[model samples]
Target: MAQRIRVGIVFGGASSEHDVSCMTAGGVSRAIDAQRFEVIGIGITPSGRWVQVAADELRDLRKQGGTLPRLSESRPTAVLLPGQAGGARVATIEGDRLTDVHDFDVAFALLHGPFGEDGTVQGLFEMLGLRYVGSGVAASANGMDKDLMKRHLAASGLPGCRFVTVTARQWSQQREQSLARIAGLGFPVFVKPARGGSSVGITKVDRVDDLEPAVLLAQKFDPKLVIEEGVANAREVEFAVLGGRGGPPRVSLPGEIVMRQAGAFYDFEAKYVSDDDAALLVPTQMDEELRQRSADVAARTFEAMGAEGLARVDLFVTADGRVLVNEINTMPGFTHISMFPSLWAVSGVGYTELISDLIDQALERPVGLR
Candidate 1:
């Protein structure tokens, strides 16, 4: 029998999206092929401690009592070390003593947001010479920062809404100048933490009177903020991109996010907590020509971001048929209900197969400077 590849499923992080990452890890843990891969759960505590977790412990990760699940620090502390041959090794430490150590072929980092998705962990993997899923360091970092992402997209000639960035230094030292720049974009702008995900620190301001408070709220998550001009009468559509085996990336059928509530955007609660607040329309109805155009743009966005393994590209489709790049999520939400997996499922790839494909792609990818 062929040897089963040991896969390190790293999830849970110090980011505000920690709960979401745990949820994603749970989904992947349950769906990953048990026959072909040996799963090792490495959960990171909210306080930034890495610990070993059993696959079964992560299976039931979900919201309870109106609170999202979090990783427990009680599990044996875990650390990654360089292996003798190449790859990486997972070592579990109990108290002051080393408990167990195992070698992993590839790291499937299911972490979202800052410490994980923003390329910090990817850089660690690069230094350790460990092949991992998703984009490389530069791509992941660019994809995480909304300001940088928009700049890259614009430089690549992708159509998008006009946006202005507010750095912490500028906001404090040159408040008047920052306000003037933002005012140029007009009202009804989205104030968002430039490096946040899961819509954790985003506020849609319809008037100038509410801008300061919104900026304050976003600044709590990230010192830098990217306030974007609102796209009027636009439909939120997303496409999932999977790296092709020694070929161009594959694009999935488009999916639409329909918020049930009036005047409400797809906020954090609407995304994970209250399912009734929004509906995910997979293979959402679209004109053939428009669909092709949007898909092509989504693929371009992925390539422009230099993403690998997988990513989800979000676009704003105006009523006048203009497709604008909203943002690209290098490590999008991956729960079963998340749009990334849902889009692929409708595109004929099941959840299990999708997980397998990502791992296979990561394993096949070259480690260190790709």
Candidate 2:
């Protein structure tokens, strides 16, 4: 029999989405094929401590309770050192002894938000010459920053709503100027952390009076904030793109997000905690032509951003039939119900297959520039 591949699943971080990342890790660990791969769970605490976790523990996280699960600080500390071609790579310290763990052929990073998703971890992987899943450094960095993402998408001919990027320095020193520029975009705008996900720090403001507070709130997650003009009577649609290692990007059938809460947006609660309140309709009710267009745009966005492995492209379809590209999540949520894997599920790739395919793609792709 062929040897099983050693796969390291990394999750949790100092980001605000730490709980969500843990959930993602749980889902992935549960779905990964056991016979084909040997899995290792690595957890990063909220305080930036790295620890080793048991696969069984990671798989049972969701069954815990209402409160989110976190990586406890009590776990044994883990240190990573490159393997000599094929040997143990992880070292755990127990008193004066050092125990070496198995070497990982590939790393599946399920972390989200700033420190994890903003290319910091990806850069580390590059430095370590390790094969890891998801986008490269530049793509991850651009995907995390809304302003740069919009610019790259726009430059690639994708249309989106008008937005103003406010840095910490500008928001503090040129408060009036920043507010004035945002005002030009009109009301009913979304104030968001430039480098956040799962709608962690986002606010919808319909009046000028609420803008300042929203901006300040968003700034808590990221020093840079993006204030975007909201599309009136627009439907939120998403497309999942997957590709790498010589193949062209394949976009999944578009999906629509319908919020059950009255006048409520898809915020963090609506996405993770209270996600049952929202419905994800695969193959949106839009006309076939529009669905095709959305898929095309999503594929283009993936290629333009140089995204590898996978990405979830969100779009706003106006009532007038115009499609506006919203943003891209290079390392999107991957729970059972998360749009990235769900969309692909509807497109015929099951969750387990999806996870295995991502690992295969990472292994096939080399560590350096292509």
Candidate 3:
């Protein structure tokens, strides 16, 4: 008989995308193969506190609204310390006295945004010599910052929209100049927190008159900002990038997101709340050449950023058939209806298979400064 692998599915974080991360963790924990591995659930509150939360508790908190998800413990909480410490890596709680339950061979981070997805946590894993799923430091950092991501995409010879990076300092001191600079990007701009996800602090400003307020709105989410030249009446197409240790980046069939809302684009509400409202067309309605081109851009974006495990590459396809890379998420959404998982599912990889493959990638990669 073989021993089971301890897998800690880390979720929830200090980021604004905390709830979404919890949901992702729940879905991942539920789908893991019980017979093959031992699963542990860990949650970090929006206040940046880490604790071990049960799978049921995470789901329960979601059903009951307004309550900030609670953490069970803080002291000696579950930390996937390097297997060097011996015993089970998952710090288990048998009513207070921490017990090593199973040696966590790998971690599947269902975390998103800021601290979790932005390479901060990934850096910690690197220091501890622990293997974890998804992109590493460079890839995670690039994926988190919109402006940096755009530069990498263009330098890789991939098509991308026009935009300018505005630091918090510049926006604070040179307000008018920053706005004027963005005006050169044309009207109908997208103001987004350079390192945010789940549409937390994104605003689509149609006219230059409404640009300043858009900057202020995005400033609330992140200090750095990226204002993009919106593609007028363009189709939102996305592709999934899956890569492991030696696997070449594989792109899934493109998917298109149709914004049915009254606003200029898919905002916070249009993303999670109105999933049924927006039309998510799979195998995006692109000519064979354009479709292949979109996929090529996605693959290039993934490789350019040195993304590993997986990424969801989003692009804006114009009415005249030009595809522009929008952004990349190292730890993209994994919900059943989320495009990352949906595209993979339609491409012949089931949710369970997708989950397993990510873990396989983590375990295969040797954890270290490498």
Candidate that would win on lDDT: 1
Instruction: Put down candidate 3 lDDT per residue, 1-370, tens digits, no spaces.
Output: 3777767777887766677777677667677766776676666766776666654554454424655443444544555455653122655555757675445667777888778888998887776677788999889998898888888887888888889999999988998898888999988888899987778778888787887788888998788999888788788999988994575699999998887754447767777676565788876667999888889888888888999999999988887988888889898888777889999988999888888888887787776655
**How many residue pairs clash in model 2?**
0
Each candidate's number of clashing pairs is 0, 0, 3
Residue 119 error, candidate 1, Å: 0.3
**Model 2 global lDDT (CA atoms, 0 to 1):** 0.85
Candidate 1, poorest ten consecutive residues by summed lDDT: 83-92
Which candidate's TM-score is highest? 1
lDDT of 1 by residue, 1-370 (tens): 5899888899888877788788888888888888998888888998898888876887778677877789977776789998744478888877787777888888999988788888999999888888888899999999999999999999999999999999999999999999999899987899999988778879999988898899999999899999999888789999999997888789999999988876789899998679699888998999999999999999889888899989999999999999999999998888887889988999999999999999889888777776
Question: So what's the TM-score on candidate 1?
Answer: 0.94
Candidate 2 lands at a TM-score of 0.93
Q: lDDT per residue, candidate 2, 1-370, as tens digits?
A: 5899888888999877788889888888888988898888888998898888877888876746567788888877887777644222666778887675757878888888787788998887786778888899999999999989998888988889999999999989998999899999998899999887778779999998998889889988889888999888778999989984686798888899998866788887877677488888976777989888877888888999999999999998988888898989988878888788888998999999998899888888877896
Arrange candidates, best TM-score first.
Answer: 1, 2, 3
Least accurate 10 contiguous residues by lDDT in model 2: 82-91
